[model samples]
Target: MSRSTYVQRTIRNTIVSEKSFKETLDSFLYELRFFHPVHADKMIEQAMEAKDPKVFDTLAEEASGRFGYLSFGDHKVHRYLNKFNPNRPVLESHAIALGTSPRAYSMTKHNQEATINFPLRITVTQRPNDDRASVTWDLPSSQIPNLHLNKTLANAAFFVDDKFEELIRFCSGTMDEKKYKKILSMDKGAKVGAWKDAGGPTLSKL
Candidate 1:
């Protein structure tokens, strides 16, 4: 469903702390594995073995073309929710499509549960400095069921920005111990609505 409540944020000209351009690119691909395990895992492994960033770039290009079929487009919302509520019924039938152009990616998820479906897109571009990148995130509405369960799922889309920032900090080796531990704790288990509440700043700005 199309609506006006889209989220858009730009992290402007953030410097890449990695030692080299290859390392910077590799770090981005490596962090993506957490959100898109199936497609990114093999590429990550191959890149590690070959010590080549091009391997990851090639795989990323392929994923960008067939974005929907990639692991991220399928049941990713369900997977995220399952981490908090494993007993919920599995999402059996859903249609998620995603595609990416040179510097932008778009995705939409739709299914029986109204809360589980939404539209999100992101774009990251290298800045003139070559050692920095500009990132933008968008979520084109929040029309989900009013139930608590659905609210969490609906809010999950907004977490993409947080995840992206986390990835960048991690790659830069600037993530503090406290923040790292917090991420780990959330990954393990947190109260319902935790994500929604924690993501309020991002949503509020939207």
Candidate 2:
């Protein structure tokens, strides 16, 4: 694509994204009390502090043609509705910080053990005309007991971006299974405490 064309597309996307974000934000804030009181402050901070709210085309579900909220931010929890953040380096650093990549939760390895400590939610909707995927990360929940927002973003980014990138690469018939399995088996660190022990991936960086 030409530079002019790319710029035009970007400008158009921004216009659409900003409008959708405002619509979603008002709805999210209105229902904040049901989710948690903490989000009231967080939502306001998110709206004002981040001048350009991040855009995540991945989590932005579409209907007919235009993207809009279907239910509960339309599969986007809070900031992630259209927020494309936790870029590549931040995703990697946060994964290391949390010590838990999304790969850590292998059902076969655990013999189907069910737990909710580190949740990496994944929803795949096959697109007949698309081959690419988008990625982003958000805090686990504003109400989780001890883990703060930054730590949660780090942990979630693994699943959202880093690990999903690998999954996409592998499924695209580019990567060999042997290499992918090796990547999966390696332990990075424990998710909850790695933040306490050795923390450096800052929120600004994320």
Candidate 3:
């Protein structure tokens, strides 16, 4: 075949392939809707007309937030929502600080039993698609905790939001090491002579 003819045929084949792929995706989405109902409805509608992967991602992200609140039974995502716009209203809360990386929680091996106090291993990863902390715990199906994991996740989100200001203040020259140490010692320590008076008897006993 001529060069022009070959190029034309290649373009035609590519178009046909894309059309076939789109058709298959449409059918799969049709079947998926039965299983997921609301999510599938939202995803399928977005997928069918979406020209970019970002659109589907947006739908998935929104659905994840909604499901997190509905299925998890609380507005966990709402607590830290202001972090995205820190200039806005501040929500004071506390959470485990894991630095720039999302917070993680896992069971550590201790005395031949699973220990929740200290994590055995920690690796940083991208933030979650939603406000839930990126923590993972060894929650066995047979031995699930009486408390919901989502509640803990929500608490973690709260901590991240609450401490952000303190962290920023420290970063932006609001709190330095010397001042912080002084504040800590002054707030927690006794007066100049309070310990000395008690120490008179304690020192004699020693």
Write the residue-wise lDDT of candidate 1 on 54-173 in tens digits: 676566555532111123443234456567878875431222333222112111232234324322333333444655434333333333333234444444434434444444555454
* TM-scores vs. true structure, each candidate: 0.32, 0.20, 0.18
lDDT: worst 10-residue window of model 1: 99-108
What is the number of backbone collisions in each predicted candidate, taken in the order shown? 0, 5, 2
Off by over 4 Å in 3: 1-149, 176-206
Shift of residue 72 alpha carbon in model 3, Å: 31
Model 3 sits at a Cα RMSD from the real structure of 28.4
lDDT of 2 at 154: 39
Q: Please, what are the lDDT tens digits per residue for candidate 3 over residues 138-180?
A: 1121122321343443343333223323322222233456753
Off by over 4 Å in 2: 1-121, 124-160, 173-206
Give model 2's TM-score versus the native structure.
0.20
Prediction 3 global C-alpha lDDT: 0.27
lDDT per residue, candidate 2, 10-68, as tens digits? 11101111112233233223222223323223433554565533312211211101101
Please name the candidate that would achieve the greatest lDDT relative to the true structure. Answer: 1
Candidate 3 collision pairs = 94-159, 95-159
